[model samples]
Target: MENYLNALLTDVMLKEEEIGDICDKACEILLNEPNMVNVPSPVLICGDIHGQYYDLLTIFKINGTPKSRKYIFLGDYVDRGANGLECFCLLLVYKIMYPSNIFLIRGNHESKDLTKIYGFYDEVAKKYGNSRVWRYCCDVFECLINACLVNGRIFCVHGGLSPSLLDIDEINRIYRLNKLPDNHFVNDLMWSDPDELNPGFSKNSRGAGYTFGSEVTKKFLEINNLTMLVRSHQLAFTGYQMHFKEKCAVTVWSAPNYCYRCGNLASVLRVDENDITGKNFLIFKDTPQKPSSVGLPGYFL
Candidate 1:
């Protein structure tokens, strides 16, 4: 029995190693690929895929391939939507296929605890007969993702600024373990949401965590010296929503038919920063095959 267990463990380790090898080779190819991240490149920033595999595929069809342009996925690649496993697998394949053009970040749903509750764990177990594939794919996710980045002038994260994160690199230092432990700040970073800008803590409507106000966002931005906070969390009927009017923060929601029937349009943001003085955005909207029966909220459109 001991030998058998040892062999099984060794097999898992070897499979993990092979996955890493494929990803590394892909990253190398991306590095050699010419002008992948050059200026004027239209950077495609997508919000929560939530395992909506067909919609994700449709996005690829509309936007062309990630190889042709820069792609930044703001996490939550799994859960709620059917095909969570497929969505994750396809992303891993893409990460290997176009390592240079794609940049993935960690999302709240990516955690094991969240997946277990939100359908991804069950989906994988149902499809694969166990958690092996889910485990494997998640390992790939943590290693391949960058938590947050100070991209020129904007600070990008899966969620928005946490009152705790004073420096951007503090986010980078968040080590990715196979599974998240309870009460960790990084866990909070992944799971927290900023719905309304209140100075005090309010219960998160989504049942995730506390709601943050403009004061937190303001202080966070002021301390970090960031001109804008670009994040993906909370659903927006129009796919992108701006807040504070004065502060340059924006939330880009990409999943359409979100939560199965939120009736929101799928969206993405394309920023052309080549001319620094005159930066502009090209917002892409996905009008689904079936028009949403409900109307968008006032703030979203």
Candidate 2:
């Protein structure tokens, strides 16, 4: 797999410029992530796959195989996991091989600084002896950052909607053609957190990342006319949990033994929606196993 990955990585690196609209490429990956959803189709939503390669394999084994059921991976595809490149390759392969069925969204880790701080940068360096794979992935990551609209009532993102994004179309208009600047609105959209936001309304916490309050979510929904927000970022003691259960918002944490020692069960959401308006949930329990890699010192944490 290493040799194959090396070769594939080389090819991608060479063609990076030719890909045209890399951000569009990312959105293409996102929109199609839920392709398995036929008319009146069900969408299987997975969360925070933080580089747990084997656990992802286990997910395929336990859940319906990607060949059968449609899947929507809710970002955070790299970092924390031992084989960030491998996990990424698998996703890209799925997108290329099963273009219609598999999908990927940009997670917080997809950023340059985060990847350099976490395992991905080091993992690539160790595997390829250079920054080739890392560079290529950065290109791909920028493209898949955000995905949305699950069951018309629900708005899906790797994290929550930011208070700054007043209009949903404003988000849609953020085309892939523009060079995404650091600390720009697009960057905040993918990396922001909802946990540390003030209860009423406020900018995200600097240390806690971009936190959003229930009111922000509520207002966003009302303005956009959405019924729910389905996101993943925080680790729940249970595999999954509902926030403001009455408001139709839910969080699914799918990384088992999250952060390597947290004991929280990993989870995924099965939207039992027959159509856009319908929304329901089925939580998947974590498959017992230790993470392949933890916060290894000097390399990643």
Candidate 3:
């Protein structure tokens, strides 16, 4: 596992068999974790990477590797980028290598249907000449946890609040192991977004999940005894956005120069006990990388 991780970090492409092995091991690790994965404090909370491989590398370059810092990735791991497969594959390797230091949550894109519609399905086929690897990735996605708690106070999820969930603990009742997204709970958690204008839950323009407002966020936080809600599913031009008095909830966007054209900044939220707000946003811009068209048409993200 260490060799695999090192090779990936250095841009050494893993053989198809090696990737399959990594995926198998990753699923094993993820399946054992609860739906609401419990994470420790003083961890970096990363948002959507969207397969900007060079930017993903920049994150580790600025902050040390998993050996030096902990991370909770609020998903959308693959899709809309040239190196989506590489990004996803490397994350799986890291998960297997450092199960205790890294955490990954499900995103709306980690689905077979969405992958097919987005770029992952075709990306895999283009890379491996078959959908075999894509299927393997979907299986691994099935085992990903829905949300995570940091130091028992911060509530973190891929998306925002669900209309059906008044209590955050209700997330554990939703079965997702090897199951298709045939349930609304998973849909809401992975697809939901926050709307600043609305005062209550409203239909999302995304055609799935609810767009919740400040009142909804406050109620959810109070009901769960949580200090803040950290989620990532929408694009934030400045890398991060605060909601409900700038404390109740936040969206952290980590894909810099989204799709290489949106000119948006990306950031990771660092949760520390010593910080005044117990969290800090570490921001960065897109880095230079070899050109490719695999992800150029990713505006749909």
Tell me the whole-model lDDT of each prediction, alpha carbons only: 0.61, 0.63, 0.83
Which stretches in model 1 have alpha-carbon errors above 4 Å? Answer: 1-41, 144-146, 178-181, 195-197, 200-209, 275-301
Stretches of candidate 2 exceeding 4 Å from the true structure: 1-40, 181-183, 195-197, 207-209, 275-301
Candidate 1 vs. true structure, TM-score: 0.74
Task: Write the residue-wise lDDT of candidate 1 on 89-144 in tens digits.
Answer: 55655666666677777787777678889988886666545677667665555554
Best by TM-score: 3
Clashing pairs in 1: 197-213, 197-214, 198-213
Candidate 3 lDDT, tens digit per residue, 171-202?
Answer: 78767764545446678888888888886999
Error of 2 at 93 (Å): 0.8
Which of the two, 1 or 3, has more TM-score? 3
Question: Comparing 1 and 2 by TM-score, which wins?
Answer: 2
Model 2: lDDT of residue 223: 88
Arranged by TM-score with the best first, the candidates are: 3, 2, 1
